[model samples]
Target: MDDASDDLPGVMRVVRGHLTETYADLIDVGDLDRRPPQVRDLSFLSRALAAQAVRILTECSAPEAAAAVTDGEGDHGIDAIAVSPNGSDIWFVQAKWSDRGRAVLGEDGALKLVAGLRRLANRHYDGVNVKINRQLTRIDEALSSPRCTVHLVAALAGGGEVTFQAEQRLTRVGQEFGFDGRTPVKVHTLGLADFHTFARLHAAPGPVQITATLTQGWHTVHTPYLAFAGSVPAGEAAAWFEAHGPHLLAPALRNTRSDRIDQAIVEQLVEEPENFWYYSNGVTLMCDSVQAQFFGRRLQGEPARLELGNARLINGARTLAAVAHAVAQHPATAEQALVPLRVICVDNAPEGFLSQLSAMPQSDSHTDLLDQVAADPQQLRIREEFAAELGKQYVFKRGAPPPAPSAGCTVQEAALALACAHRDVSLSAHTSAGLEHLFRPSPAGAYNRLFGQTPPGRQIWAVVQAHRLVQNALADIARTESPWRREVMDHGDLLISHLAFQSIGLEDIEDWVHSAQQDPDWAKQWTGDIVRSLAAAVTDRYGQSVFLASVFTDASKCRVLAEIVSRASATGNQESTANTVAPARRRRNSISVLVDHGRIPDGTRLIYRPGSPPEEAAIGDWLHENPRRYLATWVNDRQRPLIWEADQQAYSPTGLIMHIWREAGWGEAPVAVQGPARWFLPGEGTLADLAGELVRAAALDGGA
Candidate 1:
């Protein structure tokens, strides 16, 4: 088959942007610095493929902060690996960057990837480097579980087909590891053509297989498009959006808008879902083709359902989100909430009109918008006023594309920072939460108090960058054989860093940020200060590997870590004392323990304590019975125990009484029973005690 040269420019554009955004710094491009600087051009085959693999890891899979660049020597023929959100699915990507642009993976090339997968699945990781071996260890662990599904992928920059023979070879490799056809490893062969299709789908996901009730019997109506008008249950609408996340808004790296509208839409869905058909502007679905099957009319006095295949949603992301929200709130009621939809099947490509559809306004939302708290004139004034103070743009709606990276500080960043820093946590939320506003409709004070009385956005962009620097630093630290490797949370740690960046013992941190923004010299010194602080933190607690463990496990400790870092920065120690995460502890006890009191700094209390009732056997039974009772209440009453805050992307300690008290809002904690009084005093125990406390907390959350 002949490869078309025409697709190169567009495909490469997505590829290029993907490369730049995927990495926070040149360090992420690990071996590139070791090579001749020009080799870092990244247009080179191996590097390009590695970058693309990174894109697949983050974009196709969960946006793991761990998605890394591995184009260096000793990579073991593996470009990247993405652990699925649940840790059950793993994608081992082997990419070939062809100067001639061929996308085909011959059996020989596929064998290289297959060989590595075989080694990893078989737990033969000694052949790989330390880093790759660590990931392989995790892969091997997941493979032992019945739920694990590994994907063998061959990505190409040019056009070449993955022949049937290559796929058969991949199967044989999986079979060697006991993966039969029933639980066979999934295989994907992608070239530039597929990348283009993927890009388009990402821009607007389609052929989503939606089911709805036809407003009228469908006859092929074909002038503008082969079309059908219908009604869909809000639950089904929610399903579609959840299934096609980010694809529905492809090309946008993250949903970085600052508008509180999804809640209102959901309110309408719950309160007057019957009027949803009337008040709704209806969803527009684009598909390459569609087929509908009648599921019979309902005797429940509503429209009958028609199952439609290959429906891609183009114009109703907000509605989809709202439906998802409504369904989340009232599942039974959401089953009853029907929404209007228009399904259009087009043989022609859809890129041309999708953006136009996205721009088109749905009128009913306007009525709700009028009633929104953010829409109140005073809140509008505050938004405008805050925007003016920051000398930035004031965005007015949800789903508005984020301002360009160089377009100064964004409201979303400001709001997210406020939410993490302020008392009003529920004010601003991730787009997935669908309520996005902390700066407007609430207190101008959240913004005002960012610097403890001034809008932090003035210097926030720098702080955000500093936050990223700290995260990248932590990631670098975690790569070592430290016990805290699995404990790093990028964004949550960033919030803690931000909290530290605020003024504390030193001059107000915001003033420093503002000053740093104005002066490059100050900025450099400030960055060095933060780096040193994190370094010292990494090395703290007598070189204990769990030094910054609390930063990830406890939100309160996250705040404490911030203060620790800030104080270090204030000390003006230009050199970092904590260079690497400390080695694992030498355990002296089977039970939990913490660092010695003499070694532990002031304001730092022992977090891990193991002395409980001596009846260990009965305690096990007690834990087994109604195990999730505590998990349910502390994590969630209805939803699965959210051991991690999805929006915050941070871990929580399930067994910790204070964390449970705060997360579950279960009144005040029984301080005497679960307080500092029970801590393992200085020299009372070895660091072994802290280990089980952290491990148990993590296990509790994981089980929950």
Candidate 2:
């Protein structure tokens, strides 16, 4: 056995030399197969071939020897460990030889291999742990100090369910018991097809010819000539090469056969005569003087135009080559900013190729607006003022009147006086200045009497009067020949047309009254002609059209329309005040609904209602009317009390009973519920029912 192994290297060298001489362009001669013993048996022959081929290409070395090992169960199993040349690393290789006389491994086999390795790594044997423990300890120490790597090699002989099974098992092991410190343990696999390629390139001619006999009664060797390339008769070899050579060679030359090939050819032409006459098929095509001059001009940074005839083989390649050559020869200058240029050709390119070209790096040289602004101080100040209110601060001397006395004494004094005046009469220095620009002053005493410090009742009444005045002014503006007036007129026409079709008269006095009550401006714009239209619609439909009148009368329904018209009117100084109303009373005696989707912890109080307002009585009445569908509280083993309150009072009740529910296995998982049912308040069910039902619904919807 030692003598045979010693001659293996010499045999491989001879085989590699023959292959290199025969297929110089195709094969890398430096790479040659080195067979592993565990895979030497006829049953594991393909594995041996694949292991050797991969080892050669990757410059990897096989282990010194292989042996069989068992867990003291009397099981005869081979443990082929391939150690790296450095002896510091090792790969536990396992081959699952098929019993069905097929070349490929099986899924069960792969799973068994993964399981066996995992057991080996963890098990302790023979008064001391096996090398696996020592390996793992070294790995752990290496990880703490630096990085460590481990490899798992799964060698498969043929194709079958084994391939898929092996991949899945490897993935599972990697995920579950990650490498040394949970670091990745690399896994490499060699399949049957790869093995055949290796065997054809490295096996001795005589032995290779006997491959079919060796694999007999096992895998059915199809086309042995094609399998080992030259192991069969000459006639068979010719036929196999003619049929399958292209298929085998395509992937290897895919990168070279790219669309840029034409471009590469053209670029080569731009070089000297010595470079242009390069050989591919041992045929050198010389460039004529004209072609040479054209390429010369292109190389010299001068634009050269070529008009190759309609032969696509020559023209397409020439165009692409020319473009690529030009780009390569003449690069962009720093001062002359580079802009990406993409040429989209619908010719024969794949989809999105043009888009990919367009995405290449390019320069966008444009002046920055902020940088320009930074060059000027006056512009910066103006920008700052536009961003915030303009104001100045100044210190007043003890004996002197405030600085800028005319502007207003001190800033604080001026601010305080303005605030006080605004509170007392709803007007401040700002308001006074704004008003002065719009209105002439009345006699001083007359103005003082109307807006001076006065009783609270009088002040309130005056403010209401002023508000009404502002509303009336805005109403006048709505009646003017302005853009807003025209828009209202248009919408009004649309409204009248709609009502007329429904036999509702816009001219009806009741309709006018309703419009006036809701919006004074619309009422003012309802002319006699519009009114007549309304009247006709009303008479035609009788009292059935009364609903149309009510639609226009409702204030809430017209709030949005009112706001639009108010904002459009030039004199609408009180537009902001038009919709302002007293805040609603905080409702008490209210039912809190809490639905914890397990995102919140148990006993987490998400909703708290401190006190109940008078409005809550209404809510309570509503809840009382619907009891069967609603549950107030629910508790489970995983969740705390759903609802609780402090104390109760009439006007300001404290501590109202809160409705709560705990729906286990709710939302995401590890479910718990605590809080009111605020999330499900709109539903008909009570807090407890909502929580339980929602969880059940989710689970059922998921087909749980």
Candidate 3:
């Protein structure tokens, strides 16, 4: 259905194929013996209904569930059942397709929808067939609890809108069920326009409008680059992700990011929602246009909103994943977990020609980030002209094949190789915009400084090959019997690959790539030598045990390593220059400040768990002031020991939150902290209750 079906005729073919191949087993498909000749009569309705189910499953991001068509002569008017991704909501679909426009299922169709919903709510398993019966059983089990919501859907093809009379009928039937313990269950209607809208959403999810109550601080930068900066609630961000995740950046990421969403991002969303925003880098997106509305979250349901068209996110994929993960894991926390976001839409400003800039140059701070930005319609045209002349797939996405016969190298690899070797702009601009976090992020126009150069694409491809070959080789080595292998293979493989490229024979990278490209077998022969020589140099300098860890974690080491590989080191720098840097103590020191302040010296030796939160820190400080009271609070409330170790030790706040969040059977996300929050807080909690018990115990002790 998502493939090439541009017109109704094409759609008919796909639809027929779906009915014949995908849902041939459905009872509504009609038996060959009795209705074999008339089977064509049902294909349009059946296929459309099944297609709607497929759309519903996709919109819900539930690829695991199957769609079933069950409409028949004695059938209960239910055409299909689309199982919800999380089983939170199951859609009972009633579809009607008419050959002519304006012809509709009307009130009669609406009543059928209501009847089907009733069948589901009533659990009339015996009335339906084997497949629908099983689905209804699942629905019954889901509805047994008040948590899951039910959706009564009507899909109309060229049908008139559901009339008010039909709506009233649906409302009455819905109220009769009282599924949510309140008003009539809503019947979501999908008209012709809705079908097209959903298709558009799946394609780009843009020309999108994201609205929210602008929490507190937000700013707009208009000079260097135009952008909106603010934090949206995690719940709101989750809504965006739920609506159109991979599609949000489909045009930009291309294929670099994986097909299935990132798992770690999702895990954090489910397990640690409140902290999601803080853990996120926020997202920066590039849309075709942006519209801003200031009057936000007003009375009577009016809210501040942003209306963006052709909106496709350019960056912040990790953040998007985190939001996606959270929605899937703990949807309840989405609103509370606020994620910071920065949006940089397309700068379709009036074209400022290079000559204009040269004459009255407006310096841009984000030149590096926006180097290739189509500053004006003209520049975009010029870029296109150059691309046409080049006769290359000037730009490619993440997942695009990394190699091409005519082009020699993938867009990204070729651009990166040139960026490192020749500092070329034509390709680097496009490459940097796509592979930011991969090759070290840089502002687009920033590389314009390395001008007057363009490396052959073929050479770039060979270098890319060498880079992959070396990284894979290192990974293979890690799997072998070397002692420092773990350190080398685990992290910084790409970083090593980049450094090794410079180390290969003293020839310019372009020359090596050119030779490799021309010979078709050069990299296979020379890359090994480069890798071995580079490894020997690093080992000779840093000792094999400390090789990789010592290089990647420090910048000076990486540069020194690169210098060694290229033999550009004036001394063969046996010394590794060892840019004496201070030890990494940022996190440790910050944590100390949070936990150490207001502490009264205790006679007992302190037990350190290093990364404890402020609340635990406060407790540690408070313990010195009132140890007996604190200890008593825990003892009375928990009916168990407060002290885990012999000495008073601080527990990790997150570790504690995780224990509580899980111990609660993943019931709800831990309430997010707005600002600095204490660990042993007041109000309803085991710890808080323990304090009350402690006070009572103290009073009794005094009375005694």
Q: What lDDT score belongs to each candidate, Candidate 1 first?
A: 0.47, 0.30, 0.45
Q: Per-residue CA lDDT of candidate 3, range 230-267, in tens? A: 77777777677677655665342533333234444566
Give TM-scores for every candidate, taking all chains together and pairing residue i with residue i.
0.35, 0.22, 0.33
1 or 3, greater by lDDT: 1
When summed lDDT is taken over every stretch of 10 residues in candidate 1, the lowest stretch is: 632-641
Q: Pick the candidate with the highest TM-score.
A: 1
- Residue 369's lDDT within candidate 1 is 38
How far off is model 3, as Cα RMSD? Answer: 25.0
TM-score of 2: 0.22
Counted clashes in each candidate structure:
16, 29, 25
Model 2 / residue 328 / CA error / Å = 24
Give a tens-digit lDDT track for model 2, residues 480-515: 544423323322332322221122111121232333
Q: RMSD of each candidate? A: 20.1, 35.4, 25.0
lDDT of 1 by residue, 1-704 (tens): 01233355766656544434434343245545567644555434455455455454346432342344344566677777766544555677777765345657778777788777666654466657654755665665555433455677787877747767777887675445434323336777667766556554544444456566554433345576677665767777777767765454423322321112355567667887777776566677665666555455533223455455555555666677778877877887566777877766666647777556545444333323324433445335535654665555544345556665455434455445444433222222121122232332212113222322223233344344444444445555445423332233322344434433343211123334344445544444444344445445644622322212222323343444555665664575434322211222322222222222223333322333323432122233543453442321112111111232223221223224234334444221221121222334355442334445656676899999
